[model samples]
Target: MIRKLKSGQYRIYSRKVDPKTNKRKNLGTFDTLEAAKRHEQEIQYFKHKG
Candidate 1:
């Protein structure tokens, strides 16, 4: 999932909530939504690559 921050930046988060913290893990923060989305896809690809 992608969220817009108060700083006008975009953040990528895990789709599932963490059981330990009860919050989505912060995958990464990006200056632009497009970059965040691209990174999200890369993450997904790597996750399923194996």
Candidate 2:
């Protein structure tokens, strides 16, 4: 998921909460929402690639 921070940047987080931490994993922080979305797609691609 993507969230807009108070600083106005976009933060990319894992959709699922970490069982150990009980919090969403911090995927990355990006200057733009598009960038965050792109990175999320890349993560999905890598996760699914065999």
Candidate 3:
């Protein structure tokens, strides 16, 4: 999932919530939404690469 921060930045998070923290894992933070979306696609590609 992608979320827009108050700082005008974008953050990528895991699809599932972490049981330990009870929150989505922070995947990465990007300066632009486009960059965040691209990174999210890369993550999905790698996740199902095999």
Candidate 4:
């Protein structure tokens, strides 16, 4: 999902409402929406790298 950070930029994170955890948690923050997309892509890349 796309989210706005305290820095006034947007970030992307794993979709919430999937596992539906009762508790709230923050995963990351980014300088821009593009940056967030890149981060998510990088994480995905590393996960499948091996």
Q: Per-model C-alpha lDDT, please?
A: 0.97, 0.94, 0.98, 0.71
* Model 3, span 1-50: residue lDDT tens: 99999999999999999999999999999999999999999999999999
Give the local distance difference test score of model 3: 0.98
How well does candidate 4 match the true structure in TM-score terms?
Answer: 0.54
Report the error of model 3 at residue 23, Å. Answer: 0.5
Q: lDDT of model 4 at residue 21?
A: 75
RMSD of candidate 1 to the truth, in angstroms, is 0.5
List the pairs of residues colliding in candidate 4.
Answer: none
Clashing pairs in 3: none
Candidate with better lDDT, 1 vs 3: 3
Query: How well does model 4 score by local distance difference test?
Result: 0.71
Residue 22 lDDT (model 1): 100
> Candidate 2's error at 46, in angstroms?
0.2
Error of 4 at 33 (Å): 0.2
TM-score of each: 0.96, 0.92, 0.97, 0.54
lDDT (Cα, tens digit) per residue for candidate 2, span 1-50: 99999999999889999999999999899999899899989999999999
Best by lDDT: 3
